[model samples]
Target: MKRALEKLGCAPVLEAADGIAAQEVLCRHADVALVLTDITMPRMDGLELLRWGREAVPGAVWIVLSGVETFDSAVAAIRLGAFDFLPKSPHSEELAVAVRNALERRQLLAERERLYLELQRKVHELEQTSEALRRDLQRAEVIQRALLPHSPPPMEGYCIQAVYRPGQHVGGDLYDVVRLGERHLAFYLADATGHGVTSAMLSVLFKQRLVLVDATSGLPLSPAAVLDAVNRSICEAHAAPGLFLTAVFGLLDTSNASLTVASAGHPPVLHLRAGRETRLVRRTGPALGLAHDAQYHEEHLQIAAGDRILLYTDGLVPSGTERDLHRLQQVLAEQRSSVQDILAQLHDAAQGAERDDVTVLLLDAHAGASWFDNGAEGRAAAASRAPRTEQDVVFYGEADEAAWLALRGRATWMQSDVFHETGQAVLAAQRPLVLDLSACEFMDSTCLGTVHELVARGGVTLVGVAPGVHALFEELSMGDVLATVRRDAPAAPELYAIGAGSSQAAVQQRILQAHEALSSLSTRNREEFRDVVESLRGDQQAGGGHG
Candidate 1:
């Protein structure tokens, strides 16, 4: 670089005596621009000197000095990376010009080197960023896949299909088809508060809670129970605040030709029967988390052979479409075709473009009573088929709170009660609990206070809930204290009909159990159905304020 600078009209070159002396001079002034050497010298010839310069001083601009033609020698120097070659007996002006040209070439080479280094640095930086994004995407894919059912149970008489489309790196929509032994299946579609990681996270928590119901509950949990628990969890704990889920939890009873469903502040569901007859089931509960005591109700509808019950999220309801009751009637009346036909027609009616996340789960029940062995042996085989990453216990309804508290007094579990019986069950719970409100249509401060008391006592995990009631808790500031509850059951029943065994005595026992469950429901012990209604009204008022 210095040699090039001197040739740009800066300095002079020092001449040396012999080849050895020249070598020493070259070493001493390594940064010098020009290497002017004579082809014939005392100890070293110009060609030999040129070779030494090529080995030792590669960066310098060289000018060969030879009395002979030196053309071949010059070519050799050039090949050795010399910038330019000159004759020894050249005119003074020519010699000076040659030196200047050599330095000029050196300067150009130096500039090119700088540009190359800068480009390499940029390319390396871009590679690192790309690698980081790749890692993030892989992680996202893993998380999204985990949210889906590993393998939904094969529902007798029905084939199931589930599709997920994530707009960004993650999605907040989810669906599940769980097989609850006895040839029964439970299906649900839920959407979280919003898009992106946080929304996706909340939804995931909700899903885990649904599948992770406390094995200690000692009772076969129903769909209404699941929704109520989910609601209570969100209303009380780690669930979204301004956010809530619009979802449906349904049961497909293959043998009975019936479908039972409970809605949590979601779009109305459409039912397509065998005669091309259609009916729309409207949502009965506030959106999950809206009210601390929002109570979700389940409706049982009978279906003939070939009846198709279509359940979907609000994305197809077309926000404005569901605001009016008429839209539901329209959906039912126009179901002139099959389940697929109704789903498409509903989407078209929903104004597809304003679309939110759309999801549809269809249940088909064909002719005559289709009964599988569903015997103890088949149940045992299914149970032992594979080892689950997560394991949970099943509780019968007859179980008392002591059994539940003993099993999970310390672990986080959300407490929820949507049905009139559930509140009594909560009272029966001895452990501190996280409450769920996904199924409750009502709840008040009294219910909220009890929930708080439970939180103060033991560990809790809350999930699924609505916004209005969520705000109330925010107002009272109890929202942060609730952790969250999750359910892990594969199949949950929505509508429960407790019929006696055979004898009149058995019938009496069934009636007695129902009465006991209902009688036990009281604010003095546990908040009852009244508390749920009250909670819901308060939530509506709170929501109205925001609207």
Candidate 2:
């Protein structure tokens, strides 16, 4: 048997006296491809051997040989998973052919097992790689959101709203609405050449280098000068080649209601007035970083009260048509709601099919004098227009020494005027302010800004806060900005310290709190608030302040 097996290319053919010994032989050789055994043996027979081999070495093939050619024994051997069966005393040619067929079948099974294992290993590696990429994208999204403004500047008679949606986890669209002073309002919108991590990084660097005011004189820079400085910064940097930026820089003067804008290869800014008329301010020069010395020109418009301006990136409208501006303006004019409501309408109209980063900034000019100069009159006007129910009136009268203010309905831009007045009054009185917000169903950016401003003055606690309002504060990470006690909770003891001693230290603490809030807001907020805090500190140092 061994000699015949060797002739069929079975090198070093192994032999055993019985089935038990043959099982030991197979155990010693893991690479054994085929097995040939007789049906009847000493202790363990071929049928038992076949059953054990079928369970232990599933990828190997087996063939049986028996001199007792009984139909029952042959059927049992075949059922025990033998590849082929033949008589024990057979021709050498037949034995060689059977061994060849068994070896070929074994080789195919081994190859299939190897391929399946390799596939499983590769799938595991891909899952690990995908998990790592997902974490990276989440970190990038957090960084991008941190770069945006926390809340609009607390300026009077000018309402600003912004919406940003990146096509990926992070994108290249950026916008800022900052107040340079009491009279000058500055805003800028920029879009890089592409989206995702590369473009998002470029936008962050651009935001850091784009100077809004002269460092030495503290004067607001011109729209053209701002763009020129940004252009030079982009051109001189070590950015990727073929990358460029399109932007519109604008300044609004509250004194004359004039707006001066400078554009660099960006789409035109949309101007919509109360009468439903639309106008477009076209681009003045090529995109930034494309040229070493790109000169930009400025366009001036005599903006009226109630005039609306829309500044956006290219993704807000289609690239092919100029009439998209008109359509957008018509949509804007049709909505008489707040800025956030208008943005919701526009977002739904798009059906979230934005392929690039979309950024939109809407500014509405309110017809009123600055709250800094006419706080009492503004308070009266706001109070007259505010719709009050019996519950609101009762909530307002809950004050002993603390000033109680109840907010009702949606706290949107329309409520901002009253909020500013209420904030100023509470600050000037130097009393504890207890705010009742249980009746307020919603809040917008302007209302949130007002809340921040009021809390910055110290000695403020919120009572009767609804769950939605509480969750909003938590979402913005401003839960610790002020104390909020639910209606069921016991009243806080600090609410009774309106005209108490240690008022001087409390005022100083409030100033410190304001500084902390400013630090938490954004980089621009920290920079702008620096001067205000310093001025207040300077007055205190000179003994001309209440503290």
Candidate 3:
């Protein structure tokens, strides 16, 4: 029968002695798409083989041959997923037609399976591509956020508020406030030409090129010169066609209470005076990166007490709105409560519909008290009545070239004030300052603030810090900021041990509170001591019962 089937157009036909051998042949050759077996055979019958083949290879077609033309056997074979059942004495024409139909059905199913696998492969590739793009956008947003200042740099006698919000994942708007000299502060807000990666990259490049000093003059550049230099830089360095930026730069002379501003086709800024009156400050200059050697003019305004200056980009205004200057003036006039309150109102007005980056800077001339002013005469008057203790003596001595400031006992709020007063001279002196903390056993948050003040002034080194004292610095994440050298022996063994008449729990509680204050320095510091901070906090809440 196999030879006959081959002669009838089945090439390379396989022959099996019984149903078991036929099943074995199907297992060995995966390409065998068709199976023919007799109904009654040795070792595993055709009916069993049909069941196995249907489950093992559903894509293969099966045909059964029987000498006895019993309706029961034919029905049984058909129920086992047999494609066809033929009598043993069937004609060649019938066999050829059955084989032809079975082969055609098998080919169609195989083609469908191949197409389904290809579709699955394409879907997996698309998912991976989408994940990569999402990660890239997330990283871009982080880079852009890091470029902004975490906090305003220390500026004396001025109150500045800056607000920045991006419409999309990233934007092309940026503002920078730089201290150009001892009494001069230069601030600029720039909006690049486009959005997303291209514009963000340009903004970063512009910031790098826009230095505080002019390359030609070497001195701190004026507001007009800074803008002119930036204009030339954009034109020379950036070759991208049609690339340009609109910016406004302001140089503030805090000493004279005056401001000089220059513009490069940016929006007009609003100035609010003491009597609830608003005036527009404007300067006409070509937008940057458009023309080489673009000239700019500076407008000087004498800032008065209780006066406010508003700066913003065009994105603050919704598109299709009237360009009437009165609308903007009214918005700034009505929202005069606080810087944060004004920004809140503007954000509410936008209602998540902003199409571009929004940046607003408000500088209020409050003539506020100076940061360094602590009313030394009043403190001196009070100090004369109260007996001075050795604990309050923060100033130690003046060494060869470096002045030494040591903390003998508890460095709390009083010690902090003493350091601020006596240490001010050390900070101003030409010699280096060395902070000796060997005898210092404890410090509160106020003392840490004084430490930060000294470090900010520069040329201050810490020496002889023990583990208990050093824990406070490490907890505040100031370990890297202050240079400290530990002594061979613990600075103060009494700090770590129970006092002669005091309880150990009381001492530990004080140490824990100081560490808690240190942990409150920043969010990252809190995370670094999460476990220890939580455990110590739980112990404190339990009345120092836990060790």
- In the order shown, what is each candidate's alpha-carbon RMSD? 22.5, 17.7, 18.4
Please write out the lDDT profile of model 3 over residues 89-203, one tens digit for every residue: 6798898899989999888878889999999999977875675455455335545654665456567667777777665657788887777668888888888877777778788
> Which candidate should be chosen as best, given lDDT against the real structure?
2
- Candidate 1 C-alpha error for residue 181, in Å: 4.4
Per-residue CA lDDT of candidate 2, range 312-414, in tens?
A: 7877674527566666676777656544454556544664554677777777787332211101222334345666443332123222245566666665544
Ranking by TM-score: 2, 3, 1
Please give me the total number of clashing residue pairs in predicted model 2. Answer: 0
Q: Is candidate 2 or candidate 3 better by TM-score?
A: 2
lDDT of 1 at 148: 59
- List, residue by residue over 377-453, the lDDT tens digit for candidate 1: 22234344645322121111111111111111111111111121232243433322234444444444444554454
lDDT (CA) per prediction = 0.55, 0.70, 0.68
Query: Of the candidates shown, which would achieve the greatest TM-score relative to the real structure?
Result: 2
Q: Quote the positional error of residue 523 for candidate 1 in Å.
A: 72
**Residue 181 accuracy (lDDT) in model 1:** 61
Comparing 1 with 2 on TM-score, the higher-scoring candidate is 2
